[model samples]
Target: MANNTTASAASASTALKARIYKAPEKAEISGRSIFLAGSIEMGAAEDWQTVMTNRIAHLPITILNPRRPDWNNSWKQSASDPQFREQVEWELDQQERCDVIAMYFDPNTKAPISLLELGLFAQTGRMVVCCPDGFYRKGNVELVCERAKVPLVQNLDQLIDKVIEKLTEEKA
Candidate 1:
């Protein structure tokens, strides 16, 4: 009976909504949530957010990915654009509410926004950062994470593993 209940729980968690983005109204308020904060300037063809989500598909946590495929980084338009406003607001809310925030910095992009977000939550103890040595501002990121006592991984795999370990510990 215990084994059956465990299997059923795992099956149900797998079936629960795994990917969430720009759907604040449709979000599942239950269960633990991990806000995927990472490099988005890799290009239109490259989406690290989705890649991370796929890696952790087995986990039963909600993924808050703000990477909109159609996003256009028009700074001037964002101020008055309703869509952009909604997206940014949603991200902020999710960031605050998420149990864990996994951040990755791809060496290929400058990722200034990711850096700013990292600064915002580095000390919250809810962050797991991956900033490889090749990143332009890796030293700064490393220093911040070190000071904040946030776990810093050298690669995406470690980042994912850290998130999984942390969330699993919570369940225990």
Candidate 2:
């Protein structure tokens, strides 16, 4: 029993020393960013944001436009001042800094800004993932995705899983 205890203690000490001396591994998703392109006016945006946020919370990546203040009250101020422009620049910077982008398309109404972002990402040859709702798939979403060369996913759970998988593959 005494010999066994001494061996365990030695093993623990070795592990502690290794941990102290070893350099930390780089994060799997470090420096990665994602732009969430979706309809801000529709209720779908809030629902999708909640789902995406819960799914990607563990990742070492950032998601842009996950939440915004009440548009009805803030739109006037956002348009009049430079605040909206600053936010756009910030999102664009994050996009440039990221390795992959995940976008959501809701078919009830077209989000012109989202489509523009998709085009930009495509032009830059960045990895783009599209999450389109059932309604969106029946609309012009396919054309947009085709133009952007982005793979369309059906739901948020799948989107998160795919992102994690891609990050793992990139690391490997």
lDDT of 1 by residue, 1-172 (tens): 0011212333444553454543344456446778888787735224656666766656666777776546666644464878777777877788888889999898888888788899899888899999887898999998999899999999888988898887667443
The TM-score values for the models, in the order shown, are: 0.81, 0.63
Full-model lDDT, candidate 1: 0.73
In the range 1-172, model 2's lDDT, one tens digit per residue, is 0011111233332331101000011112334555555655455444565465445544555445433443333544354556565556555665666666666665565567776777677655555455455554334666666776666677666776776666445643
Clashing pairs in 2: none
**Backbone atom clashes (below 3 Å) for every candidate:** 0, 0
State each model's C-alpha RMSD to the native: 6.3, 12.4
Candidate number of the best TM-score: 1
User: For candidate 1, what is the total of clashing residue pairs?
Assistant: 0
